[model samples]
Target: MDDLTCDVAIIGAGTAGLAAERSARSNGATTLLIDETFGGTTCASVGCMPSKLLIAAADAAYGVRHAAVFGIGATATIDGAAVMRRVRNERDKFVAGVEDSIAKIPDAVKICARAKFTGATTLELSDGRTVHAKAVVIATGSAPMIPETFDAVKDRVLTNETIFDLATLPGSVGVIGAGPLGLELAQALVRLGVETMVFDKGNAVAALKDSHVADALHAILEKELPVVLGVETQVVPDGDGVRLSWSGESSGERHFEYLLVATGRPPRLEGLGLETTGLALDDHGTPTYTRETMQCGDAPVFLAGDADHDRPVLHEASSEGTIAGRNAASFPDVTAAERMVPFSIMFTEPNVAVIGVVPEDGAADVVVGTASYTDQGRAKVMACNAGLVRFYADAADGCLTGATMAGPGVEHSAHLIAWAIQSGWTATETLALPFYHPTFEEGLKPALLAICHAVHAKPPPFRDDGFLPGT
Candidate 1:
């Protein structure tokens, strides 16, 4: 209705915010998109994409060391600066390329300056501008949760955010927390001749997908890096090298030249003037939203990303952002929901990729099939490789429910598994599908053969094409 008015105002121009903008606009509403910055932590800077490029360099470095294993007799020196250069070059190319995430939407999505709530329906901008929308969405995402004890050690300590900014890699580093980020960075360092130590407070590699997959991943990591598990570290300063004073069954303190904190994450809603809005944040300042609407109890407001806490992930944030934006435009009734396949990856020594109905929170009765790289034809040809592929299915129907792999090119396979699970495809249906031979895709076939075993317990009758039975 006015220059400063719109049908929807979406905050945080990251994945979620951008997705929301597109969704709202497509539904025939003018939208204004605002963010303190674009792409937040995950996409633009230290998030998955750039980190992946770094991982690729780390892999190449590994190849240089193992060239003889590949039948090439040459020694190569790892150049850390060169690797960073490759990262910058790739990052530049990505930015120069068309960004589909922020490009081409139905309605006018204006980028506003640093925005904060001035009223229930109003936002104040950094440049003394004010905008009003029928509904507001906050998708501001998460930041690295630095532990209190580790504050003084930041000179020698770094978050995952700053680890990539190193011109020269550390000779030895202690990475706390064996989550995806920790493992990923550990592999990067270890591959580059850094004597890296990874510390997971738990069993060091309790994979979110399934324990079987975690075991395979553990085998892979054991060969590549030194790991300390089930020990809590009280991180403090100790000379040039920082000391991690830890005690458990084994009570002792260990020291490292550099310490990386990968404990967990807190919601990133600070400095946006939340105090002015009077919205509720948990003790950690994260917004509370129901799993259903993902809306705060406050009127005309929606939340997404790490802030929302349904699932703190890039894809999850993108999906939630879109839904929030669309609902903001619709206002009274929103049809969107948060159903996630949540394909996750850990770029460790033996990289892991997973998608499925995970084995947490009493999700029982899974029909699973396991295939390893050593057993698969493609893996033998790959020259130097190790890992496994496992698919989980509903035992009753043999419908493939989930899949996890810690093998080469598992990211691509995760997509396929996610599709199969979401489509409710039975294992037999997967078997009927022609998979190319001498490729990782064929590994799915053996998985189907195993699925036949599960079906035979009370086997389904064979079809005309000899499908569905255990024959």
Candidate 2:
């Protein structure tokens, strides 16, 4: 059997793994990257990019169908085959770009094999090889979690991982789960002329912690598709399709050509022989690791990306990978690094975004400023007047702490808020920034003004300049 040794060995060559390799090598540590399949990331392969492609297609169809609102009469005829073709074709180009990056890595440092932990610092490969490293990083990523109850209808069930493979849209789809993934796909499918319904046991959408924001998003999505929440849902096979029955707050039975499950994705740790690692693992089979340093307990082992389950987004994975890799390279003297502020965006129409710290409801010393798009100037002009946004700040200092919103162009607005929070800007300071007229960003002015008022820092009246009275 072949044996290899390296200063750092990383398992799973996904986003986090690749970043780890780059970081480790930059630290002057000999590194090796191993994966069963190379040149693919969850985002490029199935998660983010492809889903956005489908959403883009859906948006086109929706715009065409709703052109009457602009006094333009138009008909939208969706060709499901053509839509799928572009999604797959564009998705391939993205995957190829990632593969090209992988190709640039040195051949001697890349291994195409599944790795299982034989010890804290040793791995046995699927290709009958052994790897011993001074330090190890687990970036194995995650896979969809399918309930055993749905096993009976497995043939007709689809998850994000497999849904993109469809040659044409299904006649109808029953989506189980009302989180971001489910709602995003459900809206896209419905817009693309497929009858789609979403079911969730919880009364939430897009995983928004702020009930106000969640409710607004839920209502907006319901206008597009039947999003049934706060119900117990069951699925069973029905001829060539699947049948879904729900009980509790709402009771109903429906049959669709396929079932789409967006429940959640647990880390792919089942076959990695984690039991042999001698690390303290949680019930989810994930090793306990320090977030700042990505170190697992006191050992020279690290966990990053979806494997750590800290933050599953691509940027967070890249950051955590860099942390894990740097710490792994400097093992026995690892140092912690500062992490970025939390930020997440869902690509649903009137995009949903949650940034920084979401203050608890009615928390002391917390003030909230809200804006509704129903009457916002730009939204009214665009006929996209639907959804709401709320900003939270410390009442004592008016420091922008967090924001939750479901509104037109929120994907862009959320970034501005995140940057402001990270820069330690107060509501009044942010309000001093220029806001052009007839733009979605102008919608933020009212919310900032409200925060200034709430904190007794309202701008002086009759100021010729639009800037708020502040330092």
Candidate 3:
């Protein structure tokens, strides 16, 4: 094939790469989208969609099992095969949607082959074609990190990349890592009647930085499955299964049909011949880039999405891609873009979400407001009354800074808090907004009110209709 050239060349066809391609094209730049395979996004293929499908099934089973609390007699026999079949089937639909989007891009703009950097503005294709571009964007998505300790049980190990492909749910699973992925999957599996246990060397759960929220999550998850934290765990292949032995919080050995490793995902940057680009690399081999501009040093080459190792969630990836693409198209005249407030959610029952700034322990400049579902009216009505919600505000100004929460309807409440923080709303301002009565969202009011009082910014007195005056 003849040498290919474009004004902008984007590596990887995942969420970030696709967004970069669109942004570049819309910016009046001719672009080449290169990847080993097209139309396969991590979110659609294995990461978000598939996992959610499995979680949905698990939630159904849990609802059925706990129906008695609602004064309804119900029982469920989970068909593992059927459950997985639906997961795969629905997951394929999501993948197809991504493929359909890729199909809409002009053929001349898409390169169905792997690419490696030959120079700052040049790439060599695996198929023997060379491309020289004015600017480049690296969006190669990440892969699950498998620790070297699990090498002995490699055959029995399953990461997010391979776990969804199981033909049937395993009889038992030992999850290594207490992060969101591990805990979410472990809980789902246990709810589906599989014996599951989670182990982690750290003393936290999910991505929560607040000790209170982390402890609440750990406690809630433990009621469903054994979550052993702060432990030194050893794994080894034992016949057809894997044996996990831990000594720290407790000492015991257990065997499971499979070990799910959800430790973390590092950017997939290996073998990309980055040294030829002459860009400075960090200790972890990632190119040094400014988050605001996504430019590597002063070079035309840019990094986005998981490849940059900054906020690997889908939305952040897309946002980074847009910024990187536009900046790459603009080249040396690149402009920096403002970033959105950080927001993330784990789809556990009574979701876990962390938004914006998380104050350190005993931070004098931060005031915290808290609420517990243990006595929340709506939560008690739904029989899901357990978890904690906390809002952190600037002690000096009472402006909402961030929040870490693990509670019923937190996924929605977190968004509100994140928006309030982004809009520079203070506790008084946020409390002025209406909160419906007897709803899970109303639980957020107590926390906001606490912030108002803590920061010495009391809300206005309620009017005759029992509503605080609008700010």
Tell me model 2's lDDT, rounded to 2 decimals. Answer: 0.90
Of 1 and 2, the candidate ahead on lDDT is: 2
Query: CA lDDT, every prediction?
Result: 0.72, 0.90, 0.90
Among residues 3 or more apart in sequence or in different chains, the pairs in candidate 1 whose N, CA or C atoms overlap within 3 Å are none
Model 1, residue 165: distance off in Å is 2.0
lDDT of 3: 0.90
lDDT tens digits by residue: candidate 2, 75-163: 99999999999999999999999999999999999999999999999999999999999999999999999999899999999999999
lDDT of 1 by residue, 1-471 (tens): 234888888777767877777778888878888866454336666677677888888888888887887688877688778887777777656654425445554325657478888865788888777888888888777778887777788798878677777777777788888888888878887887777887766863834547777777787787888666777777777888888776675566677889877877666777767666666777766666655566766467888776775576777887787777777778877665847666676666555777766655245677777777765567657763577777777768788877777787676666777777778788777666656656766655666667767766323344222222221
lDDT of 3 by residue, 1-471 (tens): 899989999999999999999999999999999999885899999899999999999999999999999999999999999999999999999999999999999999999898999899999999999999999999998989998999999999999989889999999999999998898898899999999999988888885789999998889888999999889989888999998899997889999999999999989999999999999999989999999999999999999999988798999999999999999999989999989998889989879999989999889999999988888788888899898999999999899989998999887888888899999999888878887777888778778888887878768577122323210
lDDT of 2 at 232: 88
TM-score of each: 0.85, 0.97, 0.97
The order of the candidates by TM-score, greatest first, is: 3, 2, 1
Cand. 2 TM to true fold: 0.97
Per-model clash counts, in order, read 0, 0, 0
